[model samples]
Target: MIKAKQIVKKFESGTNVLFAVNHVDLIVPKGQFITITGRSGSGKSTLLYQLGLLDKPTSGDIELAGRDVINMSEDERTFYRLSKLGYVFQDYAILPSLTALENVLLPLLMLGLPDADARRMATDAMVRVGLEDKLINYPSQLSGGQQQRVAIARAIAHDPEILFADEPTANLDTETSDMILELFLKLHKEGQTIVMVTHEKDYAEKADRIIELADGKIVRDETLRRN
Candidate 1:
């Protein structure tokens, strides 16, 4: 599903060049749930951003579904991001003013779907995330986990090829975090391709593979088991 080779992301820091992600190569096949775990500032998120096409690497080659992604024009990359990728961040990334259903359907509308189609798809996504009853609730009206579920619903409403989560459980309580992790596991069981960045060891162990990074490099890549 994704191939990245010799990826490097550098930043200028007071006349010094710092590599946030350095010489990393990774491959994620279809339907694999991969967890990237590392300490703070280890570049795990940086690598994920590059792989998810949120940020282009300073130097590297990235291929998604076998098409080279690094050299695409800005518009082309934006189109690909909207059509092929889904993201869930630690903050939930939902608009507070929009209701749960509207939050999910808004992007579908942006993708040019008809209002009826977008509404139906949004409802289905909410159902999949176990949020069907809360569709009309505003963000401020829902619990933290429910809001995050709404975010997840939004991410999958259009059936993106790859679902990327960056520290998805960071802000929730333990029980809520477990619930969220289990939800991701359920989606993975149903053939969703997931790449998640997390710090919790037990949660990270649930994935098909674990990638450990440090100092902008992969220190360990372990397969806990094949799913």
Candidate 2:
């Protein structure tokens, strides 16, 4: 779960201040699948970065599962991010030299889990993403969708409480994109809390909630009913 209040992320552009995210307040409950959508410069990805703890807001408060995270030390933030959050980006972000299983296990190893434990978790995560057969393959050997699945596996290896994805299917073909979305839906049905930023309206509509942003502000926040 996340709660943000009056989040302002401003940048100095020459003499003018550009507000990428201006006074945005957002709440994402546990087990919810939410999509943030907007045109270029609309601040959807900027908002996601703030919520994902990848960047700090210039002025605002963010609570992640009830802990105040905005003021945490960098070291503390790193540990918390490793422990509680998972992330996927438009780029696969997979290491080129590492095998799929190795990539998935590295984060768990970084978390200080024993090798055996990390290995087990990593394999399970790969399986969850339908990549069990491709564990030994490197990013170069896999298809774009498979590589993305490996990235997802890496993110979920530690069983993170929140998964943040930014244009996760941007590089894939339509069929592959649909495959990724279906995987996300399956995970959500099993209680994963996902917050994804996408420019595609069809993908956004599949979520439990859709948030539309314009010029750094929320213009439409709609919660869709699931069957």
Q: What digit string (tens of lDDT, one per residue) describes model 2 on residues 34-95? A: 99999999999999999999999999999998899999999999999899999999989999
Tell me each candidate's TM-score. 0.98, 0.98
Supply candidate 1's per-residue lDDT for 5. Answer: 97
* Cα lDDT for residue 197, candidate 2: 97
Task: Please identify model 1 stretches exceeding 4 Å from their true place.
Answer: none
Residue-pair clash count for candidate 2: 0
Query: Model 2, stretches more than 4 Å misplaced?
Result: none
RMSD of candidates 1 onward, in order: 0.9, 0.9
Q: Model 1: which residue pairs collide?
A: none
Per-model clash counts, in order, read 0, 0
